[model samples]
Target: MGKKINKSSQNGYHHNNHFSNPRSKTKSTIVGGKYIYHGEVTVEELAGALNISSADILKYLLLNKGFYNINSTLDDEIIGEICLNYGFDFEKEDIVEADDFEHYKIEDKAEDLIERAPVVTIMGHVDHGKTTLIDTIRNSNIAAKEAGAITQEIGAYQKTINGKKITFIDTPGHEAFSAMRQRGAQVTDIVVLVVAADDGIMPQTVEAINHAKAANVPIIVAINKIDKPGANIDKVMSSLSKYDLLPEEWGGDTIVKPISAKQNIGVDELLENVLLVAEMRELKANPKRPASGTVIEASLDKKVGSKATLLIQNGTLHVGDYLVIGTCYCKVRRMTNEFNKPVNAATPSTPVSVTGIDGIPQAGDQFYCFHSEKEARAIALKRAQKLVNKQAKNEGVSILNLHDKLESGEITILNLIVKADTNGSLEAACSQLKKLQVDTVQLKIIHSAIGDVNEGDVILASASQAIIVAFNVHENSLALAKAKELNVEIRNYDIIYNMTEEITEAMKGHLKPTFIDVTYGHAEVLQLFKASKVGIICGSRVTDGTIKRTSKVKVYRKNNVIFEGNLASLKRGKDDVMSVKEGFECGIVIDGFNHDGDIEIGDIIESWGQEVEKK
Candidate 1:
């Protein structure tokens, strides 16, 4: 009996030892910004290297530092501070510049992180129930609570499908979604396309596919609105064929799931398909290291009292650990699940809300832990210090980009996302923007879509701070309210060429005034040609505003404006006049206005001169 008890004690000691020496692998740079390394370098020597006292170094080995009379578990802030004082930069990429950087504080190198959740973005044409489908799914599967825009911003929530986690980034703007997909964040795993069965594939649908293809991500088609009376899965599948997304039944790689999100039908099947793709992709995450990923979403936790709900991606975390989140540091006192249950630990692919910190951090904030609380504080101070220095550096570095004739100290080039009605109309609208440009500020076109704007596009535009243009498509009502709240501009246009030409002019900062010389001219009708279907040719005089063959004009009669378009093929009898003087008479034929207007010899025509606004 004495021998058996002794043997059991020995076995228990060995079991504890296994956990004590889990692995002598390289210490990872985790939260709190201290790049931890696996080496037995003496603390006094490290303190000298880190430019700190031995006591400060000693504090790095305590669990709660001097606060809780606890043994040997060190503070993360102390470790963070040591890294910071040693000239380590945690905010930037991990590079130990011996000459440039004296100390090395490293955050978890995201490159070393394993892929866990496959990022899935939902996209499709206007009113194709893209948002509706997303909302319905969020409501039903996620428990129909306040699911207002589950993807409120680029940062959104995550869902599990058969244990495979998938994060849904609410890239609010369609065009912006396209932009992000284009930037090629190697993190994307799959794109779930939502196409209304009744509406079939539209322009944005194809663009989304193209953008996904641009990013080289696989796609899963969700045939939404199957509950509708006219829901045509066959038509949706056939239309997708135009973009090469043939259904599985049709021998294509794209998996098409006909779902009625409104009716909660096929939701399970969708979840199953998502998991199937994840498994096929062989997605896995290392649950041994501290969590690290791009800040998908974060906000101050007012209601929760304290501690941020960090979505762990790489490591297991426990209560009472210190976290270095963004530039802030806080010791975790307790971890709570989504249901507010106190949990001792959270592993990779888990998002456990925690408390013990003084305040909540912002969403999308990167979080990590340190060896001790002391390290966490030190890291936070250093992060703040580095930020100040960076601000100073940018101010010095950016002044070089300016040139003479620039009015402002810094050139604020406004980028835009222009959405319009149809292909032909878009062509004409974009061709004539020769009026608005300037040298100090240039207009940049980031992206454009052809439908009502969405939240995904809005978020991207917000991130880049770009304005939006909606030619015929209006803003989504919900999106409009959000836009108004956010003060995002949504410019609408009905005329195709006018919208295009104006944006072209806008890009050049030419709106202040035309730098080139130009004049306006008017003309009156004398006789008509092709007086019926094709249009009418008016023999008229340029009365006011100097007119040229390619000048822009607006046709009007009886005080009602007929058309605001460019002068198409103006001629003086059989000769094409390059410039029609104020009094010169010319023969002009209007395109598409076949009906006879009241343009008699006494009638008038108005023209506006244009000059290129160089931005």
Candidate 2:
């Protein structure tokens, strides 16, 4: 809405009389020409007012050189154009609130602050003993209790060493580490990079190093899995040296601890090193001031309604404190420590689960405690309204513009909406996507769910300037159309590995074609027959060009790539042939591409080869 108007009297309405009979003159006058918009309206609302289907409005907007969704706010210029096209006049109506909300800012006095514990984040490659190291130090088996036997979510814990408190933030993987950092939550004071002594370094390990270096935090290397028969501490150290993390024993400043997490070997030394790093940094915070912290994790509970794990970075959090996190606030009903032990209060750098939030705040959201409940609620509601307005003002961004935005040398944030076939698949997808971040462009998942892509997903992607990633999920016709109309990128994949690889490549700006595809021939899979020798064989006919034995092939079903590989064997009338010409019958067996039940009748197969060159 625009600024408020001060007119006291209502404007007079006028109606035109064109070919009206004498009886029509006595009827009530119709205000046909003009309309006023209080705020931005959607296509569905406009269609309802005009007594038309939403689809009709969509087509109208498309024909009028506009791209929008049913839920997208119509700009003033577009609204005016629509009115003129529909033979009507329009004006904007502005209303002002009697009480404009002011932002709440808290100032802390020097006397109220004190030294606090350092918050540490454990990061490295998956299955590199990160969780194992944490469990060994805390004397808890959390890794075995997680879904898929892997930590797919962030967890914060606290442990006391030599009468001093130390907080540890363990993320699912490096992807989640960058995800939180992109959201502006820099809660980690130190990073402990765990490298497997046997496995050496991995892709995710390199990614973790890059992220921690970008955060500019001191890194402590924990070379784990030393109990394994093939463990080589020297090899692991050599690999880490490439990342500029030479061990302290090698005359470098970085601290490296060798430990076996499963056997709890050298676990105490690791904690000692962590404390030493904290001491060097001189981490301190005022505990007597109002509490301020960052959320480590948030989820909806059937019994508790909404709950969040808050890591108090500063001040003191009491049981009855009223806290505001993002656009939500609540009076703290209770607080529990990492072990779920009830606690009356939490000081700086301690992880506590709070049970009185009205709704689930997002992970990485900054929270602050107010003096009173009324002020917390007022500020939270005002923030919620501001968020809604800001989303409306952010127009959709296309993938084409993404490169340009990154090149501008500013912080480029990529928002993603992920949809998957199952809960496990969704979790895996999110975990993998979080590890993809370049220095210039950071990837953040705005929303994730377990379902097929739908219109609601499209609307959210359009509003948030996010790309939609669907894993083993297909979209309906409406959603596809909306995505294309809004120029939103929708990437679909049946294989999880492929999805991860493609996204990682995209983040590195390597999405430009690395291999140029050269089509050799096309064929149609007429029938599928079982075989013991080659798994499954497809009866086919050469439709165009020539099918060569050395050429690679790809199966396309409904214009989607199903399988791609090299041709294993080629046959013409039961005779092994080097090539098959057009209009000839043939049978083909692809190498390492077992169709199983994916290849169906009427599916098209294209034989091609790729030419790769360094860019």
TM-score of each: 0.47, 0.52
- Tens-place lDDT per residue, model 2, 427-476, is 89999889776675778776677778876567556545677899999889
Cα lDDT of model 1 by residue, 107-168, tens digit: 44445446667656676666565555655555644323325633334434466666666666
Q: Provide the RMSD of all predictions against the true structure, rounded to 1 decimal.
A: 26.0, 20.1
- Which regions of candidate 1 deviate over 4 angstroms? 1-143, 147-188, 199-216, 238-252, 262-264, 301-303, 356-360, 385-425, 428-446, 450-614
Which regions of candidate 2 deviate over 4 angstroms? 1-111, 395-615
**lDDT score of residue 374 within candidate 1:** 67
Error of 2 at 420 (Å): 24
Number of clashes found in candidate 1: 73
